[model samples]
Target: MGDNNSAQYVGIDEVPSPRAVGINKVSLLPLVFLIFYEVSGGPFGVEDSVKAAGPLLALLGFLVFPFIWSVPEALITAEMGTMFPENGGYVVWVSSALGPYWGFQQGWMKWLSGVIDNALYPVLFLDYLKSGIPDLADGFPRIAAVLVLTAVLTYMNYRGMTIVGWVAVLLGVFSILPFVVMGLVSIPKLEPSRWMVVDLHDVDWNLYLNTLFWNLNYWDSISTLAGEVHNPKKTLPKALLYALIMVVLGYFLPLLAGTGAVPLQRDLWSDGYFSDIAKILGGVWLRWWVQAAAAMSNMGMFVAEMSSDSFQLLGMAERGMLPEFFAKRSRYGTPLVGILFSASGVLLLSWMSFQEIVAAENFLYCFGMILEFIAFIQLRMKHPAASRPYKIPLGTAGSILMCIPPTALICVVLALSSFKVFVVSMIAVIIGLVLQPCLKHIEKKRYMKFSTSSDLPDIDHITNEGTLLG
Candidate 1:
């Protein structure tokens, strides 16, 4: 541990240099769109918020939920990600502050949560298309659609982050443009009173909170790709800030137009309701555009999420948390084994209902976030003078206070889960706990190779002067 009295800290100049030639690093614009896809794929799934609560509560949730969750998580990620500046991301943070055992647990829960989250996109993509092609509503046709879509998107991820990043930029623009036009066209028909409709007693607290949490969370998913980013210390924080603004507006403005332009028929506000709203406000042309946009948006979300999940596995492997095979990269600099594992997980979980998927993933995510908050606070208290290229601007006490609201929100989300989801998520957690020791035993027996990368800095050896010791 470093000396707390040390006034000196490591400078940005000491951070790792950029990767050698032949690998293209992600820059600011692509990084922002990547984060946008990671968190909110352009309000495609947010219509459920209005269905669960009224427009007023849904609007307030998007506005206030950020302060309670997104901001805190993003700030912690910015500071912790820049400090470590490597692939393992939060896993390294937890291992450095707590221990490797807990770090592995964090990796398992988070990666599982991410895979489960990725499964939702193909389901969402089909939901938009089924309206136009009624045959895709169920049966083997939907299953085949999911398979084909997942395969295509997985291939895109395998191509490389730079390609995925630019694709996200194009998809984001296409996905968001319809909503912008819809908002402009709906102005003549806008009903201000529609925005204020709410019935407190009738709200589905479970669905409402879950929907809000799902859309606004995952700001930290970008951290897993910090190593692939160009100048992450400066770029990560800036991308997160711009993405936050884009995401909030993306959800809120479309929601405002949809709710205020159409009548209050809560039952009608489901997954693809935005397309219907476009048709009602403008015409079939606008609706078709919205539908196509939603379809492509899910594609954007799938590739972005796959990149984060797969790279996280590679990151964990580099830190020796998993077997060495996981660290292997494809010719395009993508995580070969990790992408297959993540894509397979997505295929397995694709059959679950949308609500079930959201709840189960959210439950698992809550557990991982609890560990992250503990790690953040522990590092702040134990290594007060450590170098942080993008600090949160909070002291120890202030940091603890900052984490309180989000932690409380996590508790609420976990408590509201269905008993079935609770049991399933707990079983997954238990597997992680057991799997860690099993891997360790295998490593001891030389059953599979497990080695930390030589290039990573030693987390346990901070000098008294506050620099990382070689």
Candidate 2:
């Protein structure tokens, strides 16, 4: 994987000067909120952490898991994203470090995992609304609601990333404001002791870890849009740092307030339980506000995820990993085909139970992330002198050490998966393994047009050789 021959393919620095002129690039504030929605869109689903473990572990998980997972991932993204500064994000990183074949695998796995994750948002949005609109609970109305919601969000993405980025900023502010208010109101009712409750033997490690993993992960998704940001080299790293602080506090402070203020009713701490906590602390008005925030949060997450997933496909296509048609952008500069495919996946997967959706997506995401970590380390070792607009302060040994904790955490998450999720995720992996070769054959046969963008710089000067990394 560290072979020098692959280094000759291309690097972002070699690209021609002056990006496409007419494109409207996302600025810093919008990019921060976009990353915000991509990761934690207000702690809507974090109640499950308290439900699984007690208050203390739940609180600690948000605080601690970032060091284990989020920080490493964010740091890698900052360095490599500036290094590659393209739409493919991690796919570009893996392809550069590993090979085009493995890069294609990265793209497929991450895209599929993203689609499965996106599927959950529409269901979650409706789940929040069903309390007010009982008709959405089941039957024809429920299915229709999924379709309409998916269509609307898909259109928002289709309009363009600039609009989507701005919308995320708006939605993020709305989603988070209630929690800030909740924290203020809860200050009066605060019982500091409630935050300390914990029982090791009583913990459900799977649910607790899954909840934390789902909420804290996805730091790399924003890298998929590095090509869309203005002055990505400077903006990407700054945005990530800001978003990291926002997301960690977003989850932790709300949990601190919710747990400290309310009496511990562990069983009642399921999906939409925060609204209940709001009702207790403030009144029905606060409860309604929280519910509305949750619903909008889901919308923000859907668009942010769809943007990442679709642009990834466009990025892959531009790198000549997929057919040229996938590289075609709409008049609005959105990835039209990628958006359609992602929206369809969401519609098809919306029927899954909430637990099933979370488990299945987490399973697939683990595989994608493993490939990413390998690519990150391999690049650090092989291209130590490569121009990185934003370099992590770690040396080669430190980089490897940084990855070990998250890699171990990935193993734990994979081990905890149910038999059914394991089988399903494996099938998805196998399909990606086969699909890359099939696409290669089609490209050779001229069954579909495949071409790399002419604007990308060629890097045939670098030379080193070895077999792919294990």
Candidate 3:
């Protein structure tokens, strides 16, 4: 791990040009909120669990799990972000606590998730774009969408954060506003009793768990970048809270309203009846417009991931974890090389249908979440003295208490979900584990020597001994 105690110096002689080399306050919360809100959990068939698992499973997820996993996850990230606020969010924290091996595990998963997920976005975008038509997400069209998203977002990231930030603002707004309108209109139509249904009782236990995995994972991407934010101690916490709030308003509401309006889950995928919630309540003619809007929402989300993942991969490289090539950058300080590598993965997966992408990710997300929660827990114990301006107030007991509900729920979900996807995720993680030794060996070659001193050698001592420059 890079030194967190590294001096924060700036001046003509002390530093180079005083340009912004990192994140800024361009309303990161809105974009961050959109990351959690607009995409993953909603259109990804979460409501199906409610419908399939009966009212019981849906309630556990939408209501109970949010209270458990979502809130605490956000809060912990808030405190961590404000305290460290460096570059590669949880990867930085874990590296500080455990070591580079574990840190790279998280970072590699994060980057790989983005890369793998890139394929899903354009296909979703195409599906939304052709909502009025049929089979647009098939074959060449899906491939084209993948290329376009990869090309455009990669270029924007290659350019600079200023460009990406503005893009985020636009995409966040464009994505959420229409969805909000649709959801709000559909709200009054919901039956309050529908929230209480317990559909999973007689169903297969494993099936129910697999179903729940669809919703229980993926809170790490933004949180991991906690260190990169301005005033992360304050900003990240607020961002997490705001994201949860907005997710309900912009994303979940649509699902609620759409479900209420249509009263079916399996059918929602075919009709995309959620996008039509606005037309059902407020405007009939808005159907096509909303379809266009949903496509934009998916596109915006894709761009956000592309920009963030590029930075994440770049940060990992700078620490000697990844190859030096990933450290290569454009004049704009973007990691074009890493972005290209990531985009290649995206392109390869784009050929698969959206349903397949969602299925595989469903399982991978569960595994990732387990690690993320572990990262948070480890940091508190290991980095006890680290400044955490915005921390979860629960302390050790609270962290432990908060841990139970989410952990129990995840265990339940895993025990219940599709065996195939679960097995696939296990295999992927096993692949990673098998590769760790090689990565460590490569890392050793880069640094060459292990620590020999009781204390970390001072920068001057290192300079005298022909080590790193200050």
Candidate 4:
């Protein structure tokens, strides 16, 4: 942490209100789909859960893991998101409970995880299509395709959040519809015993846990966009409710249909296996549709994630945790600088393999979440009387209890990381540690402007004297 005495507090008068930015606010339906795309994207990438752990454990993981992990994270998000209701999202939550120094670290780790998570999409998009466009399997065509895809989707994000939300709605329908048809048709062929088949001794625990965690995680990502949603206090919670049900069904139903309809060949299960399952159950036409839907789903996830990450940078800048340039917005009311920064990071890291990306991201994500959980319990204890438009129905001890299981899961994820991933993620963490002080030094030298937004609600008042601000 930085020197608490040296920390500069910017009064509210110096910054502009978020409403004055002229961006279109997201409504309930769009927000739900955005969260959908952010969190699951209709099970497009959940095939590995079945592959690693078998149909039974994969299905059971989807069934039971959400209650342990997703629900708790989403609940905390709904409560804290509304209480702060700014672009900074979880960063604001951590800052209020901890300090500006830790808040910046949370933002850095989450933003990196988000970008690493996003790099998988363009590659996945191509993976779904490579069978048809054989040239894209490798060579200049594949690299160029990833770059072009990133640019096009980045532009969609640059256009605005409302557009991104509606696009998610459309992409979501197209993506899930084929699976719906597959499930319907497969009902006649699904073997009841297939869902119960599992070999515990043979399970690839690492892959199984990673796939389950990756798909169900990111529910809190939407919190970063709280300022972009319409009537965030009410809309945010309702959207999380609707999105949670949609995301779980999106995974469980497809896993049930695919595993049961087809013969059990665990070796055949990998990324893009769902389309093959569609082919067997519904024929070539269904396979093609599933592939197209999977591709579109990747695109949806890319835009949704890019939005979260870019807005997070903007939120940090607004809170005086980042340089003023990151706070700049375009005429469309989107964060131009932050978008460029996030998009650039996506391109730079796009070459990493899918599993590598997943492992690296999960590691960073676990770190950020540890901070978030601690911040959640701390805020509840330290500010019991603070304004909370959508408080979690839990007392201080209850909140801490709610966080325990997920916190344990986080430790499991961290412990499972490979040495390469552990090293890379630690390097990223060190950069955040050093960067914060460098930024503070820059601020002290008068090289940049930074200020807290007047329009933001004070979730807790943390002063230099280590007391809550009035």
Candidate 5:
């Protein structure tokens, strides 16, 4: 932390208010779709979705998950958030009810999951770029594109959130277009008979696990950014619901609508091609729109990823889990050190193990879901009377029931991720475990032995007046 003891609180006349500083509604809503839809799209989405079951079975799973799983889980999130509105979204809230160990675990998983999963964005982007420009499919150009995109995003986020939100909103708009074209044009082209004649080899249990785990992953990210939101409780819950509906449409409709437009074979072969369905309907000119959409979709993810990264860094630093330097924030409130750490990792990851990195994203995703399940159960039971604008109707039993499908789904995915990715994930977790104890020991030593010098400059003093102000 900062030298708070050396610098008096300028606003000690006013205590920190939990209400206004909570989360703004505007940022929260769009973010929900941004995080969710990315996981549910493209060749990847289709692969996970159709591998074990086909469109018919995929649809069945989606239908079963929402009422049976999503609704109750969302409700649990609503209650936990409202009860601990003062905490900086999930990290603080989870920390409060479950203790710092679990809290650190949540934050760690969220950060790593985000950084690891983001490896796919550039790879997928390269795939989309190459799909159109066939020669660029393999060499330096492909690697260059990944480096450029990631660097620029890291820069954009380093500048701060205004840029992040602008990018997110535009991305949200851009990302949806291809899906729109794909669904609107594609749906009409489907023949019901095709559904019956579907091929069976797509049924890979591992692929389905990877696919669906991502389909519904990390939506709680918006809640984490709630500290920046305007009307968090009201805006958060409503925005979350809106994001869900929009995401479901953004994802499901494309597949549904595309059934009519592209041949099943064509759809299966392309990377992130719901936008391509528009070209099928509107002609070659639609490619521009789809490309624009792909760029925008990636932008949405970059914003959330960057935001989550900085926050995780700051939170860890503030709690003394990380070095003080990593927590340092720039004038724009960007976590300069933390942001660099993430960006560097992104840069390094772009070069090494990009393929395994892509698959491993699902592994980190599973770990997050498990934590959310734990948080959901614990917070609901601990803070029974907590004022919540929304509540999952199912008391403890119902919430537990809702958690099961997702929990089981995630567990299976953890196993299903390639032996390489699964092993890497285990290694990463073990590294974290090793560091956890060292961090605790270090913090304990500091708490017992370290102290700042008394000669530090004070921040509360008036500049021209040369007087300390209350």
Candidate 6:
């Protein structure tokens, strides 16, 4: 069993130069909002759940899916994340349990999924604002908007995770405030039976599931930045608990208010539909507030997602999976090179249309999560006494049973992916497989520096888990 009491610090003396120092750790409040944005980011993007499956299933999804999927995933994350309380997050867990090869694959798939997922926010931010500023509808202006927004947010990430964490706190409050107002204002117009509406035959199951899954499933993303968290053993678990409640309420209140107050119009319930619901329920002032909140929430999501994606690369590099250049940090102790790489990917992939990006990211994300699930269960079995700071209160059999529903949900999500999404996602996976060996070859030939941190925790399994760090 690994000891939970050991403090987390990268042994960069054994690692290489440009050593990270004066690390800015994320504290409780900020960590909660970071997880909040990582997972829900308010209900700005969840309107499609109602559109696809009607109000009944959408409501039920936000209500029920959390227990089956979110809770289990969050529980596993709190356990595994604290178990390996380093920036490498799940990469470390997979490597310790499965091997470095699969760990790199998890990192690759997740980092790529995160970048692809991030591409949507800047575009959506503009979409919410474009109504008031029609010039942003398309052309050079929109492109430039995307670039500027990406740069500013990326720079904020480069500043430090602590700053990003606080920013998320502010943005989270701003994003949810209007919805709170909308929900309260909407009470007089509520039609309780409207929540019962469901068109089983007409439901677009894929869209509903995808929207629900996309909004709810990124609870594990925060694990990537666990190293920067203050007292993560205590902070991580509590933050997740608060974030889960905030996220569920964030989605449900607005959704309940929107569906019950407004007349049902399946076709009209798209991405920015909540802003319209605000207008209908309240007035132009409330509508504008919702739009502004939506835009800011997108920013919150972008910064939060970028922070995780970039740090995962640094984590991988510290494991000697990538060139040491990736492990370089800015003066603020942020992953400088990794941030550039992630930002570039976000820019390159931003050209993808919204639905296409969502479907593709979701497909790749599901693959990474499947690996994570396997890693979680395998560790519990192999290292039964491993000092998990936040163990899910379940024995080996109970743990397996708990994973069953979410793993089944993952299968359903993968099966439902569009052919185009499946093809594109598979290509991304192939790239990761090929990229791994190519990195090894580069390291073998001394073309680039690569070294593992000695401070990393050891998880000596009975099967002799081969060398994870090069």
TM-score of each: 0.96, 0.94, 0.79, 0.94, 0.81, 0.94
User: Model 1, 135-160: lDDT tens per residue?
Assistant: 89999999999999999999999999
Question: If candidate 3 were superposed on the true structure by all CA atoms, what would the RMSD be?
Answer: 6.4
The candidate maximizing TM-score is: 1
In order of TM-score, best first, we have 1, 2, 4, 6, 5, 3
Cα lDDT listed for each candidate: 0.90, 0.88, 0.57, 0.87, 0.59, 0.86
> How displaced is residue 297 in candidate 4, in Å?
0.4
Could you tell me the lDDT of residue 359 within candidate 5? Answer: 65
The alpha-carbon deviation from the true structure for residue 91 of candidate 4, after best TM-score superposition, in angstroms, is: 0.6
Kindly indicate the candidate among 4 and 6 with the higher lDDT.
4
Stronger candidate by TM-score (4 vs 5):
4
Per-model tally of clashing residue pairs: 0, 4, 17, 2, 14, 0
Task: For residue 446, give model 4's deviation from the true position in Å.
Answer: 1.7
TM match of model 4 to true structure: 0.94
RMSD of 4: 5.4
Tens digits of per-residue lDDT, candidate 3, 27-137, equal 555546434632352443344454456544544456555676766666655665554454466666566656777777777666666666666667666766565666564
Candidate 5 residues lying further than 4 Å off, grouped into runs, are 1-48, 67-73, 86-88, 197-202, 273-276, 352-355, 387-389, 447-470
Per-residue alpha-carbon lDDT of candidate 2 for residues 1-470, written as tens digits (9 for 90 to 100): 01121332323454532334587999999999999999989999898999999999999999999999999999888887887788889998888888999999989988998999998898788777787788988999999888998999999999998999999999999999999999999998999999999999999999999999999999999999888989888888889999999999999999999999999999999888898889999999999999999999999999999999999999898999999988888989898999998899988899998788888989888888999999988887776655566777778899899999999999999999999999999999999999999999999999999999877633222212112211
Model 6: per-residue lDDT, tens digit, 1-470?
A: 12234222221222222344566678999999999989879998888898899999999999999999999999989988877777889888898889999999999999999999999998789878887799998999999999999999999998988789999999998998998899899999999999999879998889988898899989999999888887777889898999999999988888999999999998999878888888899999998999999889999999999999999999988888888888888889999999999999999998888888889999999899889989988987777656566777788899889999988988998999999999999999999999999989988999989998766656773223222221
Residue by residue across 224-264, what tens digits does model 5's lDDT show? 55545544555556655665566555655655655534556
The top-ranked prediction according to lDDT is 1
- What's the true lDDT of residue 215 in model 1? 97
